[model samples]
Every structure is written in structure tokens, then in C-alpha cells.
Target: MVVPKHGVFTTRENKVYQMKKLLVSAIPALALSIAVGTAQAGETLDAVKAKGFVQCGVSTGLPGFSVADDKGNWGGLDVDVCKAVAAALFGDAGKVKFSPLTAKERFTALQSGEIDMLSRNTTWTLTRDSNLGLNFAGVNYYDGQGFMVSKKLGVKSAMELSGASVCIQAGTTTELNLADYFRANKMEYEPITYDTSDETVKGFEAGRCDVLTSDQSQLYALRIKLSDPNGAMVLPEVISKEPLGPVVRQGDDDWFNIVRWSLNAMLNAEELGVSSKNVDEMKGSSDPNIRRLLGLEGIKGEGLGLADEWAYNIVKQVGNYGEAFERNVGSGSPLKISRGLNALWNNGGIQYAPPIR
Candidate 1:
């Protein structure tokens, strides 16, 4: 493990006092203005390195994104991204500590520093990005809000539902979006609100609701829990743009860069044809891009406070972005989300990245 060099809190006196080291949560942050002048000292990278793990905020129980097994083994799309971050930091993907939170608690958790970063399927919006003091590092999943209705309803499209009672997760932006959509179109809806996704799915399946509304990706996961999944169909209307990305606390630039670049590195790797199974052979290849990406001859990784071969370590340990997507949600996979918007820009999608150089 690469341990960062530590620094001490500057003190002028010859002796250190520890008897009354008291901290008050209620103390006005006005006191902090006196004791501290700048944004918290070192970046989050150094702190995470010193702590030996990345505290990643994730979804509570999204199946293809962040679900644990009976033995507590975590494996999913978001989990893989966290693992990739761990690999970039410590060369070992197992060093991540996943902290799951509900939609209501997620942003608050990141703000309070309860988690180092948020790898949840959080939508990046103006309010979240600017008003809430959070930064979206990069988009990992390109998604949009959609409707899922049972085939028995015979609803071919979302526009067909004028008076349908929809089962929708209560605390998310989906609720507001649904309201606006229905109101603008002059349609009436009975919103069957639920505190959690499971409850919403249950409400839809138990004949309590004729439709369910949420992110298209989430609807795909929720569809499987139905007794007759084939009886339901997700409508083609994508109501809103949900650019899902890993978010970091606003103040730490270095930590945010590390997380952001780590995700871009994975995307770049896949675009360059670098895969986990063949990274070893490519390590000694003749391609200049490959050498630069693997940090064989470039000083790229050092900028992110990581080892020279950070990208190589991530691809070797956690696999590429496509591999992560395929393992969790793809053809022959359970969550089967299409690569429509998530595909690379070269492949007629918008998932492009800046040059590493």
C-alpha cells in the first residue's frame, strides 16, 4: 500500500497540550473562521491514504449497482467503480469501505464528510452541483426518468396513461418530474408514494398501482421482482436527463480529481482496447498510447496522488468500464441495460473523455 507522507498541525509552542482537547458540534462555525483560514488543509486524497481506505457512499440496495451477497461480498456496477477507486489509491480494490445510504441521506452524508465520496446513482443537477456545495466528478451512467407499466394495462406509451395511478419512489426528483409532466400534459395521476424502491415495486405488483416511475436503469432492476415480469413494459419516453456520476465534497480539489480521473482512465482504457484479461500482454506493447495510459513512460498518475501505474492497476484489478457494466447490467446479465447512451463517443454515444496528456 502507498502511504502518503504525513504532516502535523502547525504549533508555535514547545509543548503539546492534550488534557482539554474538546470539540463542540454546536459551536458556531464562526469559531472555525478564527482557527482556520483556508479550505481544509490537504486534499481528501492524503486523508484517504492516511486512513487506508476510501469511504464510498453508495445506494442502499440497487441490484445491478450495489447489492451484497449472503456472505456480504459486494459486487455491482457502482461497487466496481468504488473498487476501481480503491485500486487506483492502494493497488488493491479490497480497501474500499462501502457506506450505503438512501436517496434522502446520500447528499447529506457526503456533505457531512460521513463518506469520502458518493458513488451512488445520483442525478447531477444545478441545485445539487451549485446550491448544495457538491461537485460531480464525471458521469458514469447516462440515464433518464421513465415509466414502467404492466402489460395488462395495455398502455403502449407513457402518454397513454392519463388517469393511471403510478407507484413512484417518494423522496427523489422523480416525484417532482412526474408531477410536472402530468400537470403540463393536463393528466391526473394518483401517486402511490413509497419510502423505498422495494415498496414501490411491491405497490406496482400488488395491484395498488397501474404504473411505476423512476430512472430507466432502476426500473430495469425493479422489473425482475415482479411475479410476472413479462407482463410489464417500460415506456419509451425518457422524461428527464439524469447524468449519474460519483460526487465528491465541494472543497477538496485533489480528491475530486483523483476520483474523476480514475473513472476517465477506465473509459479511456476500454476505448484503447485495454482489458483485464490482456493488460499483461499490452504492458510490453509498442503502442505509445498504451504505454502512456499504463504510466510506463509518463508522469500522469502522479498528478492524482497515485502510483505511476494507477490506470494499469485499476484495469488489472477491477477491470474496465465496459467489463463492469457487462458484469452487472448487459446482455445475458440480470439488469440488462442497453449501452445506448453509456457507450463510448466513438461508438455513436456521448461518453467521451479529455486526453490524458
Candidate 2:
């Protein structure tokens, strides 16, 4: 993999030259000229383009967001985001290599350039966005941390448990926040920490802990595997903020734009009602915005460094954000998560898209 150039923004021509040289060396001569690259700090865009795929970092086994099948094929909301970026870059959604990562390894994996971007269920906190030398493109899921307790515990409220043992994932804000909530409430509790999501759930199930604390979305996703989902209840107490989204290493404008716009494309597609089932038919509608969006007319594709028909490619290949959500977390999905803050902005939700001009 070619490492992206870093530093304060400097010369555009320098980037082009570096990308060109790298492209010439890495890819076939035919591919060099066509690649529009913004690669490593001083390297050329062509160089990264020649590599022919985006490397995405994601959770190892979150059912609604990331999971690998017995055949090792990965799919979920996060996987679909990767597919959207791939579709934008190559016009083929399959052009990607997914790297499964643990919560502890996700940031380090991105900072070292081991992966290009992370679409895992990472929350955007002040400490992470500003202090960690990373950038969160935007919040895709506005979530909050909560707890799940088995009915056997007979605890109706989070505060009712004065000495509950909790199983929380390590290397996550959830662990720290879990402590803070208990401390501030003056409740005595014991925490069982584990490095992986599965391990944490198992620890809670094995009677090692009385509660499993995590993002409400994750708790819901994990609840299905319980011996009986109805036997466990998520406490109404939501302790901390968890605004999750795609993340990229700092200082790569070209790559950053691609990831940011790829997300925007999905959001905009949903706002325009351009679902896969009807996007093509909407192409002939009189709505000018829809025309521009679906690539039926206008230069929407080229404006984002993608083909003019890029939006069409996305809906055709991976589906819109709403479809991906319903497939992964909504009523149709195993998680059965409600569209709380993730609803469309106009519909009293937070998922607003920038104008696709």
C-alpha cells in the first residue's frame, strides 16, 4: 500500500507530480494518465489510484454494522459505507479489501496508515476528534451508551442496582463513561473488562457481571443472541454521547473528500428518495434536483471526482442509506433499532446532507 503524503497543506502541483511518479511506477502505463490522485503528503494522486482499492478499517463482528460470514464475506452498514466509497472510486462496489479491527486497534490502525479510513461504530468525542489527531467526517449515528441486564437480576432501572457487576468493552469510551456514571451516581459496582465485543457479551452471559453496558445500538444488536431477547431489558438510562461516523487520518484532502462525499451521496440519495427500487424511474421525473442527483442530467458525478453517473451506480450497486439502514438495523434487520436521531433532518432527525451541488 502507498502511504499518503502528510504536512500542512502546501503545493497542489507537488501532490500531482508525486502522484504521477508513484502512479507511473505502481500501475500499468495505460492507467497512469487517467488516475486523478491526491495521495501521500507529497506523493501524486495517480500513485494511490494505481493501487486500485480503498482499505477500510471496521469492527470485527457487530451484526448491524460489520460482520463476516462463514465464507469470510463481510456485510453490514459499515461494509456498505466501504462499498459506497468503492463504488464512487471504481464505479464497482466490489473493489475493496476490508480489514476487520478491534475497538482498541481501530485508531492506531488508521493513524499508522495501515488503513485509509475507519467506518466502525466509533463515537466522535472532543477527546477523539480534537486531541487524537484524527478527523470525524460527520455523525452517521447519533447514539448514547446504555446498559442491558438479565431479568433474573430483577433490576428495572440502572440506578436500582447499587452493587451490580458490569461487563464493558475495553479500548472504548464506553468503559470510561460507564465508570463515570456509576461514580457520579454514588453507586458501588464492579466492572469486568474484555477486549472484544463477543468476549464482553460472553462475560456478561457467564454471570461474571450483572450488566452489559455499551452503545444502545450495540446493546440492541447483541440482544438477539441472548437465550431470550425479551428476558433482558435495556435500562432507560443513557449515560454519554456517542456520535458515530466514518473517520480518516488527518491531512489527506483528496482521500478525505472522497470519504466525506461518499457519505454525503448516500444521505442525499435518501433525502431525494432515490431508493434502488425506483431510482432509475425517477431519472425521467420532472424534479431537477433528482435529475442532478441520480445522474440523469447535470454534472453531479464529475463534481465529486467520480463519473457523472456515480449516484446511479451507488443506488444500483449498494442501495441508498435508508435501505442499508433498514437492512442492517431497522425492522427488517436483526437489530431492530428504531430511527431515533438517525432519521432525516427534515423529519426531526439529525441526518442532514450537504447540498449536492
Candidate 3:
């Protein structure tokens, strides 16, 4: 046996002792981590159930996505997503509240648990999904970055805006996309950053920037807010792929499933031709796909910890995805955006969802 100094041991004995000490010191931290993970897994759903509503985070005032009216009634595609989740959980779409958040405040609001889910037309990226400790439930809107300039500017193409001043919302992926796009094209421009889409549009209208650059859908939404909508035109150059969607914090599979399937229910309902106008009748559908989606049979919602009528409630109260899209941002609304890429997969677009079963 190797001799040791006072209060010491052999080398191998000391290594073992040190490892034991390290493990002993790490036990509490490991235990706490597990406890926290467990707490987070089901906590959001339990709290939402206890409170009787979902607190959804949304954009401050982005038209067609999550804007509020004169009487503070929130309506838009993103708002409909919140209502859909509420309807799925509580069987009542009205049992939800909206928190108007800026681009900068959105992720933090969700991370801090101030909101159960974020439906703020946020883009999903590798960094956001992995680094922010959040998971994007799914893509609700397939978008792309584009430029909008005053008709008087005679700018028919983004290539012409090389030396222009661009108004962009701060704390968004658009900034990075704009930089990459301009750099790749050997173009140079001055950027005027604002905190919100509203402020960004205001900056553009105030002549602080020569052009407003944002998601193509948002460009259309903002153009209508202009004093003279016809005075501006969106350029045809699409610079980046922006898949906008609802986001939920990581570590809560139950809550994640609820939010994801809520959107999925809307999408599947639309694909199956089950709208709010015909959901009740569709419940008696002979087609297994329709019957399963309406929770008439197969799986029947128990897998998601929801009642069999969960999907029915979502469709009846919030309508299908197609209805929400048309009412908020498509041809039925002021934006009048064509369902080019947002159309269903069977309809020559990419909006496809898994079956409820």
C-alpha cells in the first residue's frame, strides 16, 4: 500500500475519494434538475386548467396576424390560433387572453412563463428552436422576406434599392436575412431599426427610410395601413424563407402536443372539408378520416389528454385553418394575399398535417 501524508491517501484512493466528493456535490444539482424538468412537463397545462384560460403572447398590433379592434377585441390569424388552443382545452374558444408583445419581448415572455404559448407570427429558425429553449409547434404561415417601396420611387426590383435606407423591425430574423441578402448581392444600404412593426411602418411613412422590408405577408398588411395604400408596391424579390408559427417552451411535451394538435386539428379539418358550418354534421361522417378527426372514433383525444369533442370544439368555435386564413389574411380580408404557398398540399401548396389517429 502506498503511504500518504497526513490527511491524505494513496493516489488511487484519493482519485476515488475525489470522484465520490464530486458526485456528492453534484447530487443536489442533479436532483433539482430532474425536479424542475418534471415540474415543467405538465405545469403549463395544469396551470392553464386551473386558471380556466390560456394566456397567449402575440404581436403588439400586426394586422391580419394578431391585431385588436376599437373595443379591444383581438382578431387575426395568430389570435385564432390562441382561440383554437383554448377551444381544444376548455371546449370554449373565448376562454383565452392575449398579451400584446413586441418582437423583442416575445421569446422572453414565453420563456418566463408569462404566456402559455406564443402565436405572434414568429419565424422558426435553427437558433430559435435550439438556443431559446423553445419548440415551434408547426408552421402556420410560409413567408419570405421582401421589400416595399413607394410607387414614386420607381423601384420595380429589390436590386434597385442598393443605396436605399431600409426600415426594419428590430430583434427579428429579418435583420439578419436583410444583411445576408444585401451582402450576397454586393448591395449596400442603411438600416433604420424600430422596436415594433407599427413603429417600423411609422418610420417608413415619416420618410426616415427609403423602403420598408419585412415578410411579404407583412408588407401587404402594412401597405394597407399606409395613408394611401395604392402609393406603395411590394417588390417581387423574395430574399429568405420564413416559416412563421406558434412556439412553446421546451420540456413540456404535453403542452406542446396540445398547441401543435390544436393547429393540426384546424388544418386537418380544413383538408377533410369540415368547417365550422358543417362540423356537427361531419361528426356523423362515414369516412373514417372525418370521423377520426371529429373524435367520433379512433384515438378519441385520450392520447392528448383531451375530451373526444376537443377537435369538434376547435372547429366549431374557431373554424378551420382555411377559414381563419381567409378571414384574417387571404382574399376575404383587406390584405387579399393569394394562397400561393399557404395552400394545402393537395391544392398545390404545402399546408399538410398528420391524421388525428
Candidate 4:
């Protein structure tokens, strides 16, 4: 893919171009607005309500996470999160417009009010949470970094990748993890960095690099884009922890709570055996937790400035967390990824959430 210009930025020589600072400097009023947290704090929810749609930030094209089709239709796990939020607020799942963003542009876009929330596959780290003035709602996908290489190379493991040139995208945790992994193993490899994920995969496909490294989930998505999908194998080694999720600017307690609970609604739905196919029926059940969750027994959404049936709208329109996973990246999708670490807490994984009550 081509690297975006101007409004978007890229990394070079290990230096991240601060588009946020530059853009803020260009508009003094905007800089001041940001300084006082007026850019995205308390205004987000009201702004979204006034606009009648949520402007969600997403990756340019990462299949099963966020990708647009040839006809401009968007789907994937991240896209569904945006839809879930819209469903909660407007009672309409389609009330959203997506802005495709690069890794370098995602943060600036959110900080500058270019997008309502960032549901792109971003890692939650201390540096980002504390320094960027952003808050991670919760982990939607638990992932780890791994390597991918063409089967022709005959490399069975990452340890055998010494001296190999690797293709990796810029402005991501994978870059630093690659260096650390090689240094820890006392191995040396040439790093070929690109501005976008598509560019990184294309470089690998064109033989500019001998291997590609990223989150294993991304490896699966990228492999499918290759000319010979079956020719590449993802290494079994997971190098670093990557808790990927949606992010909202810090200080918007109301907005943050809404987004956070939208996701938790889906998780709780799955845990409660609620699915879109049966949500309407489940709403009539006598279970107190399910009753509160579906707005039948409590004013659960009052504190979030939403209708009591907010979660019901999400489940009825967008399905639960497990439903989104199964269709986007699990058994029903091309990736067919197992819910290894993403399963519900009672079902062998740690995806737990607080009760709506």
C-alpha cells in the first residue's frame, strides 16, 4: 500500500514524526483546546449525539480486524466495536462512518477530533496509556508477536532466522520486539521497515525481506493477502505480550464509560448465553443479571447517559463478543483462529467483565 501523505505521517530512521504536535501548532486554538482537554473530553458524547453518527478510527486494511471491501463496505472485529457503540447510542448499528488511519495517524486523529474513538488493533502499554493521554477501555483481543516466513526458506523456528532480512511495519510494538528478540538470542537480522501493513507484506511478497514479523493474528491476516497464501508459515514462538483493544481520549468519563461498557455488554452477553439470534427471547427470561443487562430490571445505562436498553440494542443489532469473534476471525472467517486466549472466563479463557448491576 502507498504511504499516506500530509494529514498522515510515517516513521523513519526509528523516529516517529509527531503529527499531533505539528497539527496542533498549525492551529493555535486547537492546541489550547487540547491543553485544557476540551478537544475530546466531555464533548465527545454530545458531539456524537449531535452528529447522529460515530466517527470511528480504524486501520486502512487489516482483514478480520478492520478492512474495507471493493465496494467500500467495512467489517471485522474493530468495525463491529464501532457498530456496537452506535447501537448503544442511536439504537442503530449502521449509524457510523469509518476513517481509515495509519499507525502514525491513529493517535493524532483521535486527539485532534478527527475520529470519535479508535478501535484499531492498537496495543495497550504503559507508555501509551500514561504519556499519550489515552485510556484503553479493555482488552478485546489478547495477542502476542511472532514471525512468518516462506516455506521455501525451510526455517522451522525463529531461532533459525539469523542473518535473515525481516519486513516489519513502522510505528508499532513489533519493531522494538523484533530487535529485542534477536538481541536476546544473540542473533543478527536486517530489518526492513515500511510505512503501512500492506507495504510491509508487499515487501515480503516481493522478496525484499526473507521474513515478516508481527502479532501472530496479523500474520494470519497478512498471509492470506500473499500470492501464495499456503507458502508462508507463522512461527510458533510468541515473543511479547500484546493486549489489543479500543481507545478513547482520557478525561471523558461519560464517553469512556459508554465505550467501555459497550464492549463489556458484548462480553457479558456471551457469558450469559445471549446471542443476537436469541436476544429478544432472552430478554424475557427471569434471571436478574440477564434482566438488568437487557434493561428489564434496572436502570443500568443511566449513569452512562444512555437508554436503559442500551446493551440490548448492542446485542440485538451487533451480536455479542463471541459472535463477533467467531464470524470475523474465528471458525467462520478465513483466518479460522481459535479462541485460545479470548474465550469467556467460565469457558477456559480470561475474558471476564463486571456485572451490569
Candidate 5:
């Protein structure tokens, strides 16, 4: 037998050894990719069905978006999105649980499967959608970053905020936008970061910071939480686009479809003049679009693996998108925000959705 040099191998042996090493090295990553792929392959619906509810991640407490009442009941535009999903899945809007999370904890909760979906007024960005293994279902709220200053500060515009100390929630795109806006305008600002929206508002209220910066919608929401809601006013300048919406894990397209279409169903229902008050009567209408959306004909939720009455259930239980907005954040609510960019496309705003059929 030929003696091989120590720690060396023949060409054929070396090839086998290298292949084995490569396989060994790749096993963990390969296993992870396969596992992720398997998990993404339409398992969430079945899992949710087995559990009898969707566990939704929401903001700890952001009024008009996601906030809990004194009685521990949650309601808001974002919460309604979760309710819509539950209604679509279970024919019952109440078949969902909410986990309150801060800006930093939202994604980890979704990634780790702590929640079936995140409906926490989260803004959709390229990094979040592509890099974070998540997908934004759709834009439920079209918003922009703005500053809220105490009227006592005599600041009327964001341009007047130069050198001001800004209280901002940490782990949000607001930080980057604030930096960019200040840098581009040759302004200097001292940032006071907090872990939650409530904390940021508290910092502002405590005079720890001169200004509070967040999405304009959130500014309205946070302002209402203050001891004197009218004491602070939102600046007129809109610094950045913030299309806030629901999010889900990337691997599960079926679950994604369910969430996306659930929102779309609401938008479509609004466009077709369907509302919670009239959904039952509209179900018998001869309009193809209305019929299709209400599951009277057309696809009838077959493609989404949901009941034919999924859209109807969503509208009846959760209301249409416009109703949710008006009820939670618009004229009817404390915020009383106007339907500016959030109006339907036909109504001159950009809130459009694909047809149900």
C-alpha cells in the first residue's frame, strides 16, 4: 500500500473530501432555507385555522391607529385591518388576539411567529419589504412625516424647527427622515429618542424635547393623548411619504394574499358603494363588481382558500376601509383628520386596490 503524506490525500480522495466539507458547511444554511421555504408554502392559514384565531401584532398604544381602551378592548384603523383578516378567515371579526408591541419589537415578533400579522401603523419601505423577510400587505393609511410643536414655541412651520430638540420614537424611519430633512435644510437638531410613542410624547410633554416628530397621522394621534390636545399644533410641512399598512412574513404567500385581499376587499367595497350597514341588502344586487366582491359570483374566494362570503364577512363585521378610517381617525373620531391622500383614487386620492375578480 502506498503511504499517503500526513494531512494530505490523493486527487480522487481530495475531491471527495472537499465535497464532503462543502456539504457539511452548507447543511445548516440549506436546512434553514428549506425550512423557511416549507414554512412559507401556504401553512399560515391552516395553522391559524387550527388555532381558531389570528394573533395580530399592534402598536402598544397609538390612538386612531392601534390603541387599547381602559377595558382592554382594542380598536383603531390598524386593529380593524386585523379584524378584517379574522372576519375573512373565520366569518367572525372577533376571532383575533392583539399583542401590543413597540417600534423595535414589531418585526422580531412577526419573524419569530409570535404574531400571524403586524398591523401596527408600520410604514412600507424597500429595506423592510425586501431585506427583513417581510412583506407589506397594502397601504391602509397614506401619511407623511411632520413635526408637532407646542404652540407656545411659536413655531409655525417645519422650517422654523432649526436647532430645535426633537423627541422621536426610536427604531422607526422617522429618525432617518428627520436627519435627512434637517441636513438638507442646513438645520441642526438635538434628538431625544424614546422606546415607544407614548414615551416620546411624554418626553415632549415634559419639555425634555422642543418638538415631537412622527408621521402626521401619528402626530394627531399622539397629540390627542396629551393633557391639552390643543396646546401643540402639527407643522404644515410634510417631510416624507409614510404608507402605513399591515405586514406579514415573507415565506407565506397564501397568508399574504389573505391579508392583502382582506384590505382590498374593504377598499373595493367602498368603491362599489358597499358598507356594513347595507352589505346584506347589496348582496342581492345585479352589479357584477358588487356581486363579485360580496362573493355572490365570480372568483368567490376560491383562489384565496377562504369561504365565498369572506369579503362579505369582512365588510359586515369590520366595515369598509373608508368606514374604518372615518370611524377611527376621521371626522367621527377624536383625531378628526381629513381624508387627504387616503381618499379613493376615483375620489382624487391614491388609495386604490385591485378588483376582487
Candidate 6:
């Protein structure tokens, strides 16, 4: 039999000998020590680095939000946020794998660590922020819930849809808001719930519900998916405040800061007139904000535990906030939605970020 050094046995005979010598009462303590050691390994950033990429959670398929083509190529504003994080971490926007999740599963996925971050169109709520052990990085898309109905229904406003069957995604703020909106207005409506947005669209398209309700942005995206896109009309009334943004697990302030600043970097890039098209040129500008943002004069990125050029990578690879919005859901795409509340603070809208200084 081979003897073991330090009483750490390798061979089966030595293991049996050690087991015989060791006290059974100590097994629980030993197991606890192993558990604690495993847990102390590291947090999300270390795990993300070890894996060489960030795992981002996104919608299953919502054009202008997140969608995968036949070749598994992902696109949309939410996808861009994940890409920006990747650019910050790995300097490669393509260094990410998107796990498409439904509204019902998004929170649990983030809570269980199935995803490093959730870039899906999720709303920030008091209950979620205070109870879910998650943090909202920042508002990426400011939206409001609205109703869409076929032109044949002759419904011109949400107030006219009393006792209508509304198709809504289960496990979403939209569902809760729908109830609140109708109750406040002293109206009535039946709800048809589905697990995914696509399913909700399908149910609406199939005439299973008289109306479809969601964020105004989503109503636009889903309207285009209908068989007769022109036949559906989104009501003018904007109900319930929906401030959608990316989310990360709680307990890791470092990772939270990284995600939050990645978005803020994009917002500030737009405000500073730095874009993927001219980011390199803007790096040489005399403006201190531009220089600091582009990593020419400051250590902001390093402060976030990232490369000094982290914001530069995000702007170089992902473009500014306006560019992403216009391309994904604005005039550049089928949605053609105007930048109502999403415009920069200096412009006419409220999309503002803290100074890079």
C-alpha cells in the first residue's frame, strides 16, 4: 500500500486507512470548510473572466429589442448593451453569448446566476429593486404601456376598450399595469396571458384576444410582425410609466458599477458628440470631457477595474446611444419611433448621464 503524505490519501487502500483513522464527528466540519473554500473562489467578474466572455440574458425575439437570425447572429438595442459590456471587458464586442429568456424566466435567470447580466427590456420597480436582490444599472429605454387593436375593431383609444380581452405577457410589469390602468379608469377587461412576447403576439394575431397591450415601444415592434401590419393601430394614450433598463445581480457592487457605467458611457458619448464613426478622431480633441472619456487624460476605466480605454472600446465598437436607438428601433429600423423621451439632456429629451470628470 502506498503511504500518503500529510494524511491526504490518494490510493483507495490509503483512503480507507485514513477514513478509519479520521473521526466521523469531524466530517460535517470538513464538509463545511470545503463549501466555504469553494464559495470564496470569487464573484461574477472573476467567473466571467475565467470563462472569457460575459453571459447576457435577452428576450427570445423582439425586433428592435433583441432577435437572433438564422445564423444565430443577435441584434437590437438590448444586444448592443451586452456588446458594449463585452467591449469594455474583452475589447471585443463579439465576445458574448446571449441566452434568450422569456419575461417569466428573466428574473429567475438573473437571480440564479444563469446569466451574468440581463440586458432585456426590463422595467425598474420598487418591489423588484427592494425585494429581488437585483440592481437596475440604468434606464436604457424610457417607455409607457399602450394598447394596440385592429382597425376593424374601430377602437380609437384605450378608454374605449371596456370588457375587451387583452393579450399580455405573464410575469411582466405590463400585466400588473394593465390591471391598474383599467381599475383606475373604472373599466373592465379580460386578460389573455402568455409566457413569451412572441406567444402574446401570436395570440393577438390569431384573434385569440381583442387587443394587445405592452410598452409603447413593444407595441410598435410587435405591430410590424402582424400579418397585416397596417391593419393594427396603437392607441394614442400612454398608460403607466415604464422605465426599462438592464439588470444585474445584487451583492457585487463592482459588477453593478461596470454595467451601469457601460451604459452611462454610451449616453455620455452621444452627448459629447463621440460616436463609433468619429470616436478615434474625437480622442485628439482638446475638450477635457472628451479626452477623459476616450482615455486620453484620465483613469476612469481603471477605477472601474477595466482598461483605461474601456469607454473608447464601447464607443468604437457599439456607437453612441442615439446611433443605437435610431438603428434598432427608430427611423433607421422598421419601427421608425421618434426619440420622444429618450433624447439627450442637452438636446430636448431627458436621457442624461453624469459627467465623465
* Pairs of colliding residues, candidate 3: none
Task: Show model 1 residue runs off by greater than 4 Å.
Answer: 1-43
lDDT of candidate 6 over 1-357, digit per residue (tens): 966654554444545565656667577657556544443457988888899999999999999999988989999999999999999999999999999998988887887777899999999999999998889999999999999998999988888999999999999999989999999999999999998888899999889999999999999999999899999999999988899999998878898988999999999999989999999889779999999998888676778989889999999999999999999999999999999999997778899998787
TM per prediction: 0.88, 0.86, 0.89, 0.89, 0.89, 0.88
State which candidate, 2 or 3, has the greater lDDT.
3
| CA RMSD, predictions in order | 7.7, 8.7, 6.7, 8.5, 5.8, 7.3
TM-score head-to-head 3 vs 4, winner: 4
TM-score of 6: 0.88
Task: Give the alpha carbon lDDT tens digit for every residue of 200-311 in model 5.
Answer: 9889999999999999999988898899988989889999999999999877789899999999999999999999999999988999999999888998989999999999
lDDT of 4: 0.91
Cα deviation of 156, candidate 2, in Å: 0.7
Cα displacement (Å) at residue 114, model 4: 0.8
For candidate 6, the per-residue lDDT at 352 reads 92
Residue range 221-270, candidate 4, lDDT tens digits: 99999999999999899999999999998767788988999999999999
Ranking by TM-score: 4, 5, 3, 6, 1, 2
The alpha-carbon lDDT assigned to residue 123 of candidate 1 equals: 87
Tens digits of per-residue lDDT, candidate 1, 1-357, equal: 753344353442333243235345336556545433332545667778888999999887888888878988887888888889999989999999989788888887777667888988888889889998799999989999999988887889888899999898867889989999999999999998998788888888898999999999999988887788899899999999889989998888888888898899889898999999999999999888889899987776778778898999999998888888888887747877889999999998888877676
**TM-score of model 1 vs. true structure:** 0.88
> Where does candidate 2 have its weakest 10-residue lDDT segment?
36-45
TM-score of 4: 0.89
